[model samples]
Target: MKMSKAAVLQEYQKPLQICEFPLNEELQPGEALARVEMAGICGTDVHLWKGELPIPVPVILGHESAGRIAKLGAGLERDWTGQALQEGDRVVWASSIVCGECYYCRIKRTPTRCLKRKAYGISYCSNEAPHLRGGYAEWILLRAGTSIFKLPDNLPFESIVGAGCALNTALHGVERIGLEMGDTVVIQGAGPVGLAALAVAIESGAAKTVVVGGPAHRLQMALEFGADAVVSLEEFPTAAVRLEEVRRHTGEFGADVVLECVGHPSAVPEGFELCRDGGKYLVLGQYANAGNVEFNPHVITKKQLTVMGSWAFEPRHVLGAIQFLARPRWRELFAKQVTHRFSLDQASEALDTVRRLEAGKAVILP
Candidate 1:
């Protein structure tokens, strides 16, 4: 057994504990070991800690992770043996593991919905002992079937830590929405997910883009990222008014595409109203306990709007997001998006920082 320090979630609505735990020394076939260099605290982690989102307790909590391969297991070593994955080879991992035998996987429809799906920080497979999984730790044991990819040498660790989660989600949504060149887009919320969607929209050749959210700095960052206009929802009362304002800024009808990244139930109704006739609305946020938003069916019937929902991401999107991060212009985007960093020991504080919306994206470095 190898001893490692990890942040454990012993109870909901309580501070996470930094405790030492035992990890299996031997890696099974197809499994690999990594020494975590950095892990970003995501909004979902906050929901899990607040008890708003249901997750198995007494579990280690983290998914947005980046690290280096430390050791390779038996049979796998010969092919990947002596691969010289040094102390800092920089890498990121995909979050979910799907059961290939399930109905969804069999049909290749939605592999993410496989009956035996297990996420890194959310669900635990029987094979993984309680302490062996999760990313808020110094050492993490990657199970068999986990998709691991080498990080490009030129990319910064901070630029890709949360890319596996947030950026991948954005990429998935963008793909589903099928963004067209010269299309007008409106992004709701300036949080990590919203910001990511905005960046991808611009990179996809959006002719005009608008971002709606609160706090001056977040809006400022939206403008810096090529948003033609920004709306501070802190002063707005209803989605109708917000949509009206967005229409005035765009052509008086609405945007060709609307991305609801806020996850709040209210944003759903607002997003629907902001989408132009025949346009698409992509919901990328996760709203667990949020109350329902009332919308008229006539809106969709009359406008012929195409509404879609996107969750985490498939492996393909993860790969594309990593490649997107490797672009030369990525440095400028990172300069504004990554605003804070914390140590793994300060996991609770890091969660609080993201909860209060005090930073663009906060990462915990181990």
Candidate 2:
């Protein structure tokens, strides 16, 4: 058996241990092995390292990835949307595999909330079979029924890595809320998710978009990504000040929509304060259990605000994200968001850079 290199998380809050594992060179009935070109270190990955999200130990930690197909299994002929697939085609795969029979999948039609969903990098244990499950390794095994999308020749890997799961997640949330033309949007936290939400809001024909978040660099990128006005967390220094700035931009009516893209618990209550009467508040962050915050229910009733929470994305959202990135306006700017790249051996360093908010979008190039 051939061996592949992987960075294993043996314990929580510790650096990944580099090790070699036997590769399942031969594909099963519908499996495909992709040689990882670049894997992104998402904010969720940082949360996992901090033990914010519960998971099985001895796992290879990475989910946002892109690569070339090394091989394919029998009976697999086309991509997820019916495009032809072949060896050496550049591709990106959906992160999770959902059980189609679950209530959320069958009845609610929300496959992302399927009861028995198994995510590629997060759920797969390195101690199990087909050990090359995560993108932090040289190769990842695409199990049966995984939705894979072939990349066009002109599409750069940096664009996909720059957006990563953030774009897909934003696509899902925006679709849920239904962006209308000339809508005024206020987006909180200028991280990848926030910036991606800004991009979506602009494309959805938002008349004015106010971005709140920062360390200066991200807010600058938000402007470049088409935010009409920006409120810096560093400049404001408090939620009250930030809310005042947003109100100023919205002419004291608040905003048509306020999106909480920052995963911090404190951002939740403040997000409610930014929404106008009868406005919609979309919470795209708080995906992991980052603890809880106490907030009064009276705010919801008093403001007549619609509160909606979006979870992780589905495969169609990933496909839509690719199409959105393929646009000329987004391709170049999105690529620039990937400011840092490290080799697979430096996975620990990549996570640290993201945790410190020092890098735009950190990627691991194997």
TM-score: which candidate is best?
Answer: 2
| Candidate 1 deviant stretches above 4 angstroms | 75-88, 125-130, 162-164, 287-289
Backbone clashes in model 1, listed as residue pairs: none
lDDT of 2: 0.91
lDDT per residue (tens digit) for residues 1-366 in model 2: 888898888888899888898887778888998999999999999888888888888999889999999999998889998999999999999999998998999999999989999887799889998788898999898999999999888779999889999999999999898778999999998999999999999999999999999989999999899888999888899888888988888878899998889999899999999988998999999988899899998999999989999999999998998899889889888899999999989989988999999988999998
Could you give me the TM-score of model 1 versus the true structure? 0.93
- TM-score of every candidate relative to the true structure: 0.93, 0.99
Best by lDDT: 2
Please give, for residues 1-366, the per-residue lDDT of candidate 1 as tens digits: 668888888888788889887777777877778888888888888887888767777777888887888876655432122333343456677877888888888886788778888887777522346365788888888877777767777887777874437788898889887999999999999888888898899999999999999777888888877789998887665777787788888888899999988978878877888988998989888645655778888888788999998877887777787779878676457634767778878998988988898988888887
How many clashes show up per model?
Answer: 0, 0
The CA lDDT of each predicted structure is 0.79, 0.91
Lowest summed lDDT over 10 consecutive residues: which window, candidate 2? 21-30
How far does residue 163 in candidate 2 sit from its true spot (Å)?
A: 0.8
